[model samples]
Target: MLTNVAVLALDGGHAFELGVFCEIFGMDRSDDGLPPYDFALVSATGTLVSTRHGFRVEATHGLDRLEAADLIGVPASDPDVPQPPQLYEALRAAVARGARVLSICSGAFVLGEAGLLDGRRCTTHWRYAAELARRYPRTRVEPDHLYVDEDPVITGAGTAAGIDTCLHLVRKLQGSAVANDIARRMVTSPHRQGSQTQYVRRPDPGRRSGSLTPVLAWLDAHLHQPLTVDQMSRRAHMSPRTFARRFQQEVGTTPLQWLTGQRILLAQQYLENSEEPVTAIAVRTGFGSAETLRHHFFRRLGTTPHAYRRAFRADPAPPGR
Candidate 1:
């Protein structure tokens, strides 16, 4: 039912967020047995819009194109700048007519201006979460969530999270088959596990050639080894307590937590790009067994390794030399 898609562009937009919408919805994927969306970029202010990075984009369509759209997207824009009256009214009209609306990052602020975020659970980039909450007190802003789907209004957290939000909408409307196909074409994960909390950047640990750099590098190289705090401390020439404290100081997480995250990332690469069995991948990633791998996978990603492979497995490489 979500056939026609339109992205509303305003001045001072983030080009990357706009491109996320364009890449996911603007392409024709019928050759892959996927639905082709009738997509357009409609200028909310005028035909020419200035990007935040000092570039200009000429949107071929105007606000009139929004009337025919079944799903509307608002990419990241200047949150402090007030939205145009006509733009706000147009957004309200679309929602009132039963057309679903989505916002990526700061675009949620636009929805708030349009009065669509009141009493709604939403999210934005973690950096702007405080301002979004302060400006829209009635809205519950879950900063740690990658995306929040409150039915007619969907909000994505940050840049890459916008891709997750768009894929989710596709999965919801069509099915996993279509969404997975599109994700494969885009060369991204079909379904990413975990919240944005894991991605929030921590304060700089100060020293460039810190004491933990070598230890961290070693851990990355030897994820398959049975590593423990005692072993790590021995390598770093520190006591277990000192090593734990140093690890947290430099990495923003404990030794075990950092190792688990690394293993999971490696497992994800294998799931998407290789034909290796789940058990084999488990052993390679230091999970010892498929059961342990599945436990961690479910806890972190909300999906099994096999299911993730099935959804994200890439097309076989062309026969080569």
Candidate 2:
């Protein structure tokens, strides 16, 4: 259903953010058994658009292209520039018809101009977060997140964070396997949790001292086992309370939440790449039973295990086979 994709070309756009959309959605991967999108770059006014880096790119289509787009990407542009009335109306109309729009970095300002960010939770580059909040007072701006997904409108933070936001839409619309395969091709993480904090300047407390890398690696290898905060604390040679505090500090989440996330990720892999039954996958991922797995899967992913497998399973055989 998300096959048609278009990117809006504006003057003084960031080339890297535009390229991120082109790379993720414009590439053809049908030979690799992945779906290829009907992708286009469209200009709101003319064909030749200038970039913030003092370069120019040409768009073959105009605003008419946006009408058919299931997902419209708005790359970073001059936030202070006034958007065309036609472009703003087209964006509102597209969203009105159930089409989704995504913005990268300062592109969130364009969405705000279109009145799409009103009363929605969004984010932009940290440097511009306060301005975005001040301009769109009704919207909740979370500057610390790598991205924010308010369903039909997703906003990414900074430059490279656009990659995370785009991959997340793929995982949401298609499935994890498709998103993961695309990410592997692009040499990036498929699904970085949206709650993960942005990189900030912090003093290093010496290399490899009091690090939790070994513990994390061990947990990765033992995802099939029932992991507990108490057990993990003992393995790390710390009290349970201390371990919980450290996990929140280092991982941005509590130990059990992180472990549940890991198990859910493992279950997603099995559902996509294997023919294992739901019960088998639940047990394999340490969910104890299929019912528990379904509860967590739906709670975390908003889809049941069977439904997710049907959408994402990679089997290539013909239906009758």
Candidate 3:
């Protein structure tokens, strides 16, 4: 039922993060048979909000707009700056009334200030994760995720991941068909599970040797085959010990961890787009059995494979144009 949307335009907000909210919720897409949201940009500080990118945006609405919103989007702003007390009060009121609040990147800090993130699991951009955790010790901070949906408060990782976070709320509240159609209009992937890693490792420019790109590309093609660190190490021309170290440094995760994530992603595609039984999909995605698939699905995605399929299976397209 999440039809009404309001985004907070805080002073010094990051332009791209604010744009993510506007792009996902503000546009009129009823022509595509999608539900249109009553959307507005509410200036949390003042009518003229200045972005960190050296531009000012005039928000026609103010904090009063948030009163009627089903979803309130808090885009990234200066985490160090203290938000107005009234802004935080409005947020708590909205959540208390059963509305949802979503934050992109450092916007999670604002939620932390409002006491919304207290005792809740949340995430933010990797670069700011440590600070967020340090600032709000009551909340458990998961640094690696693209987003975390702890019901009333949703937190997204860095810039592009904001799109994933917003679409997820839409999918959860509406349906995957609607989320996917919006994503198609936006020219982006329809669904990236919140459990997916942020992939924050940056390549060391000083060391140009022994990139694992070839092995990773090979692994993608051979996911159906049982894979082992030793086997992959041989393909990368390194010993198991060296390969494992390099993979962790370059990929921000162990090879086995990365492999499991990739397999789960492949299984998700099968469940959504195909009518194959769970056992078949498990084998196809290298989970080997439906039981194993369900275990990983629940652990990583917080749902059973059958439930995921029921929620996300694509709807049949109408015959006539």
- Top-TM-score candidate index: 1
Worst 10 residues of 1 by lDDT: 199-208
Ranking by lDDT: 3, 1, 2
For model 3, what is the C-alpha lDDT against the true structure? 0.88
RMSD in Å for all candidates: 7.0, 10.8, 8.6
Q: Report backbone clashes per prediction.
A: 0, 0, 0
Residue 53 in candidate 1 has what lDDT?
94
lDDT of 1 by residue, 116-180 (tens): 99999999999999899999999999997999999899999999999999999999999999999
List candidate 2 segments past 4 Å from native.
193-197, 202-321
Task: Estimate, for each residue in 1-321, the C-alpha lDDT of model 2 and write its tens digit.
Answer: 789999988898999999999999999999889999999999987989988888899999999888899999999998899878999999999999989999999999999999999999999998898899999999999887788899899999988889999998898989999999999998877865433231332222233234676787777778788888999998889999999898888877889888887788888788888888889998899998999998987776656878777766788346875
**What lDDT is obtained when candidate 1 is compared to the true structure?**
0.88
**Candidate 3 — which residues are off by over 4 angstroms?**
193-198, 202-321
- Give the Å error, residue 121, model 1: 0.2
